[model samples]
Target: MTREGRWSEPYEIFPQASGLFSHPVLVRISSQEIWLFYRKQQVGESISKPYVAFSFNSGVHWLEHRLLPPGIEGTTRNPPYVDRIRNRVYIPSFSVYESPDQELIGDSWVEIYNFFSRSWEGRMGPILGGSRNQVPIEPAIVKLTSNKLALFFRNASVEESYICLSVSTNQGISWSKLKNLPWRSYDNSISVQSGRNGKLYLFANSAPAGERLTCFSSYNEGITWNHPKLIDSGYSIDPSTYLDRQECMHHVYTSKDAQGTQRIKYYRIKEDTLLLNCPACWILEDVQESTEE
Candidate 1:
C-alpha cells in the first residue's frame, strides 16, 4: 500500500497449501522481509494451517513452509496476513472445526503469530457476543496511518449478509465490537490498501450478471466508498492487492469456472489498460465477449 509496482509471474505459489482446501487466500509483501500469507488443508476434517513463504528472488523461487506452535496442533481457516504496527509484527487468522458447527456459526478463535518467539497465541471467539444471528468470516487486515490495525470481514447468512469491521490496539491480541457495513454481496472478497493521500482503495466483488470482483475507493479512511467498477472481464474473485515501486497496483486472483477451465491470474494496472494474457492467467475469451456491452 505504500508504493505501487507490477507483479511478476506468480507460479504455483502454494504447493504445500493443498487438499481439502476450501478458501485459498494470500496477502501482501513485508515492510522488512518479504513473505506470503497462505494456508494448507491436506486433511479432510483438519482445519487449514497458517503458513509463511519467504521470497528474496522476486517470487521466482520461494522458501515455502509451514509455521507451527509449541504444543497445540491444528490447522488455520484462511490465509494469515501480517502487518507491522509500532515495530510489532501481527499475524492474524481465524480457526475452525475445534468445536461444533464452528465454521457455519463462526464460533472461532482469532490468533496472532509472534515472529520474535515463533509462536502463535490467541483469544477464543463467539466474537461480537455470538449474537446467535451473525456469522462472520474472511478477515482482511489493514494498517491505518496512525498505526492501529483494523480487521474487516464479510458478515453472511441465508437471512442477511453485510461487511463488518473490528479494531485491535495491541496488535491483533484482542478485538472490539463486530459492526456491520452498509453493503453486502454474494461472495465478494475485498482488497484494501492505504492510498497516498490517506484514502483507502478497496476492491470488492459486485453483483453483476457474472458476479466478479469489483472496485471501490475510499477517501476518508474507510468511512465511505466510491461506486463499484469492473476490473476485468472474467469471473474474478478473492482479491489480494499490493503496490510496488512505481505506484501501480498489482492484483492476483483466481479465474474459476471461466470457459469451464480454472486457472490462476496475475495482473497489474498501469494508466488504464488491463493485461491478462500471462502464463498464470486463464482466458475466458467467450465470457469476455459476452460481458462486453
Candidate 2:
C-alpha cells in the first residue's frame, strides 16, 4: 500500500515452488474485498493454467487459493473490471495452443464471471482472426457505459506493430472487429482504465520492443487520443493500473535493472498532468532540454 506517496514494504501473498507463477491481476471489489488471479505453469510446459485467490481486507491477507474451473483461464495481463451495478466481472484472457509443427498460437477472449451465482457466465471472442500480420493478444478492457465496453489489445505482430481496439455495445456478449489504433506497441501488455472524470487513460510501451512507457488520454471514449505523456524510459513492460486515486493514477510494472534483472516498480502520475493537450514534439523538446540541464 501507498501512503503519502511512499510505498510500503512489499510482502508475499502467494507461495510457489518448482513451477512458474506470474501475470498477476488484482481486482478490488470494494474497500475491503479483493480478488487476485494469475497464471501457473509447470517447468518445461507450453501451456499454463489459471488460479485465483481472495483478499478480504484490502489485500492485507489472501486466502482460498484455488484453480479456476476447467477451460477457464483468468485475465492474461490486466486486471478484471467489476460491474457493481450488474454484479459481473469481465476478465480479458487468452490461451496458448501448440500446433503440430511446434508453433504456438494465441486465442483471445473475454470471460464473464457472475458475482450473484459465483460462476463463469461464458465468454465472447477470439476477437481477431488468425492473421499473420495482426496476431492480437493480452486484452485490456474499460467500461464506457452501463452496457458498453472497449477493449485494447497488444499486437504480437513483428511485421506490423500497433495497438488495436474492439468495442462491445451489448455488454461482453459480442464485440466489433479489431481495428488498429494510432499508437504503436509490439508484444507488450497495455492497460486501460476509465477515470471518474469521464476520461479513458491508456498505458503502453511506446517503443517497438519495450523502451518507453507512455500514457494517452481519450476524452471521447477511445475514438481519439490526445498527445501522449512520457512516463518512463527503459525496458518497462506489462503496465497495469493498480488504483485510481482522486489526484493521481497508481500503476505497477516491471522494469529491468542494470544487470538485466526484472524488478517490480510502482509509478504514480497526476491525472491532470496527462490530461494536458501539449503536442508530442513539444513534449519531446522539453524532455531533451531537461536532460541537458
Candidate 3:
C-alpha cells in the first residue's frame, strides 16, 4: 500500500517449492533495499524454521534464499524486530518438546542477525514460563540502552495469563531471570520501541476482561512501567507498532471484520499524544489515573 491509501495488486513474492513458506518478517536495510526472513514448514506438521531473502528494489524482485541458524519447532506470529542502533536483527521464536501423554512443552529462543556479515546467531531460553503447563512464546525485544537489552514475552496458558520481562546486559547472549509484570496480557503479542523522549513504549493486548490494545511507558528502562492506557478496542490482538524518525508511531494489528474474517489494521499516532496518554515512571500513583483518562 502507498501513502495515499492506494492498494497495489498482490503478487507472488517468494514461492516455496517443497513445503509451506509463511510468517515473513520485513526490515528496511537501506534507502532502496529491504530484507525478509520467513519460516518454512512442512504440510500438516508442527515444526518450522527460518529462511532469508532480500530485495534491492523494494520487494519487487527478491533474491538469495538461505536458512537462518537454529531454526526451531513451533511457529512465530510476530516476526523479528530490527534495532538500527545496534545493527542487529532479533527474532523471538520458540520450539516445543513433548512427553508420552502428549503434553507439549514450549521453550522460547532468540536469534540475532548481524547486518555487516549477513549471518545469524541463535540462543534458546528459559525466557519466561519454565514450569509445567506454563508456555512462554511470542517474545518482543528492544535495546533498552547502548548496553542493555530487554526481552518481554507472554506467559501463556488456557487459564490466567500475563506478560513477563527479562533483561540482558551483554546484547542478548544470555538473559537474566524472568520477572512477571503487573499488566495482563492474554494474547501473546507485545511490541517495544524507544521513543524520541528517551522512554521505552510498549504496545500490547491487556487481558483479564476485554481485548484491547494498551500502551505503557517506562522511563527506568523496563525496571517498572506506569499504569497502562487503552489505545483501541474491537477485538484487537498481536500488535506491532514502531516509532519513526519523524516522531510518528506506526502500528499494525490483527483484527476481525463483521463476517468473522481476520484482517490487518494500521494506525498512525503522534508522539505527543502517546506520551501524554501514557505517563512515565515519575508520575505519582494518585495522579496516574487523572493523566490517562
Candidate 4:
C-alpha cells in the first residue's frame, strides 16, 4: 500500500491448497523482492501447514509456493522476522502432541524458520508448560542489544497466563528459562518492537480491562518498563503488526467491522507522549553502540 492510502490490486498466489489459505505475513527483502509466509489447512480442521512464496516484482508476481517443515502449525498473528544484516528470516510456529488413545497429550513443539536455508528450527526445548491444551502458542521476537534477543509468547497456563519472556544470546538456537511478564495480555498475540529512539515498546492488554489496548516502554532493553498508556478501549486488538519510526510507532490491529467481520486497522502513536512519565529514559545521544543484533 502507498502512503497516500492507495492499495494495489489483489492477486491469487496460494490457490492450490485443499481447504483454505490464510495468515499472510509479508517481509520486504529489497526494493523489488518480498516474501510472504502463510498457512493452509483442511476444512473444519484446526491444524495448518506453513508455506512461503516470494515476490520479485514488489508483490505484482509471486513465485512458486514452498511448504515449510511439517510437525508444526503455522501462525496467524506472529509474523516472520527479517534480519537484514544476516539475510535470514525467522518464523515462529507451534505444534501439539497427541497420545495413542487420541487424547491430547502436551504442547511439545515450537518451530522457527531460517529463510536463508529455507528450513525450520526450534522446539519446546526449555519453556515450561503443562498439558497440550495449556501452553504458549504465539512467539514474538525482538533484538534487545548486541548478542541479545528476547522472545515473548502467549501462554495458556493460568499460573503463566501473562505474556512470558525468554532471552537468547546466540540468536534463537538456545534460550534461557521462561519467566512471566508483569503485564497481562490477551491469550492471542503480543507485540514487541525496538523503537527508533533505542527503547523497546511492548503492546498488550492490561489487567482489570483486558480489552483495553495499552503500550509500555522500556529503556534498558526490556529490563524494566514504565507504566502503560492506554491506546484504545472496548474493542479487541491483535497486536501483531508493528512499525517503528523516528517520530512515532505504527501498528496494524484487527477489529470488527460494522457487518461483524474482522477488519485490519492501522494506528499511530507519537513517541513524545509515550515517554511523558518514563523514568531515566535514554536519549539518542546517550546511545553510543548499535543495539540491533
Q: List the candidate 1 regions with Cα displacement exceeding 4 Å.
A: 1-37, 41-50, 53-64, 67-87, 96-104, 108-110, 121-131, 208-210, 256-258, 270-293
Model number with the top lDDT:
2
Highest-TM-score candidate:
2
Per-residue lDDT tens digits for candidate 1, residues 141-233, read 677665556666666554556666665555454566666655574566666766555455666666643345765555555555555457766
Ranking by TM-score: 2, 4, 3, 1
**TM-scores for every predicted model:** 0.65, 0.81, 0.76, 0.77
In each prediction, how many residue pairs overlap at the backbone (N, C-alpha, C within less than 3 A)?
7, 0, 0, 0
For each candidate, the alpha-carbon lDDT, in order, equals 0.53, 0.73, 0.67, 0.64
Model 4 error, position 76 (Å): 3.8
Report residue 134 deviation for candidate 4 (angstroms): 8.3
Q: Whole-model lDDT, candidate 3?
A: 0.67
> Taking the tens digit of each residue's C-alpha lDDT, what string does model 3 give over 136-217?
6677766655456677777655454556667766656667655666676674557777665347778887754336778887
Q: Please, what are the lDDT tens digits per residue for candidate 2 over residues 166-233? A: 77776666676667777776667788878754577888888866879888876666665678878888
Q: Please give the TM-score that candidate 1 achieves against the real structure.
A: 0.65
Q: Which residue pairs clash within candidate 1? A: 4-244, 4-247, 5-244, 48-75, 48-76, 49-76, 204-214
What TM-score, to 2 decimals, does candidate 4 have? 0.77
